[model samples]
Target: MIIRKDNLLLLPEVYLIIASIFYWVNTSTLFNPFAIIFIGVLLYQVIIKNKIAGLLISSVFILLNLYMVLALISELSEFTTSNNSFIRLLVFGVLFLGLNLIASIFMFKKHLVK
Candidate 1:
């Protein structure tokens, strides 16, 4: 099998798509159509290796993840001493969101350099 750069770049997009699916499942809401649309555009950018569009989408991804991380951090702090399922969920959210944020930043850098 051949693994190209574009294929490798699909990793973050796939992760975000899966995360969005989980978000929709858990929340039972389609209130964030903008994100869904952006993700579709981001996938297109990755497939075509469009540097400008990729950078723009990656910037939006990074900002959204950062905002989520900060919001989770604020919520987590309120239950720092608790040992509950919700706390565990928040911790995992923060961890995965941080990873997502880092991946987005790296993706953005790659687009910028190209």
Candidate 2:
């Protein structure tokens, strides 16, 4: 059997999807923050380079953030929660979304103008 080097590039993303699914199944709280950051970075990279990869990564990031946002909103009855942790999570999510959008726009413009 011959090995293809191109397939190796997808390994990390595949692994992350699997792990994220497992974390969801286990109702593990620890995975959300890490997963969000990981997916964010991956999305940023893809957005700056590959359209197909960027679409895939961005979709996953949005889905994951939706889950996290719903969880946070549910946990806190009011938006004004005294918990710093929840505030940080919310801030991070918003920032990630903004950064991804900015990166994507720049990438698109760069490619279009070239």
Best-performing candidate as measured by TM-score: 1
Instruction: List ranges where model 2 is wrong by over 4 Å.
Output: 1-48, 78-114
RMSD of 1: 2.4
Worst 10-residue lDDT window, candidate 1: 18-27
lDDT of 2 by residue, 1-114 (tens): 876754554444444554445555556675577656665665455345565655555465556656666765676555565688777767765665444444444434433444
Across 12-68, the per-residue lDDT of candidate 1 in tens digits comes to 767777666666566667676865675677668656878888788789889988898
Once superposed on the true structure, which residue ranges of model 1 sit more than 4 Å away at CA?
Answer: 30-32
For every model shown, what is its TM-score relative to the native structure?
Answer: 0.78, 0.36
Q: What are the clashing pairs of model 1?
A: none
TM-score (C-alpha) between model 1 and the true structure: 0.78
Query: What TM-score, to 2 decimals, does candidate 2 have?
Result: 0.36
The 0-to-1 C-alpha lDDT of every candidate, in the order given, reads 0.76, 0.55
Model 1 residue 99 CA deviation (Å) reads 2.0
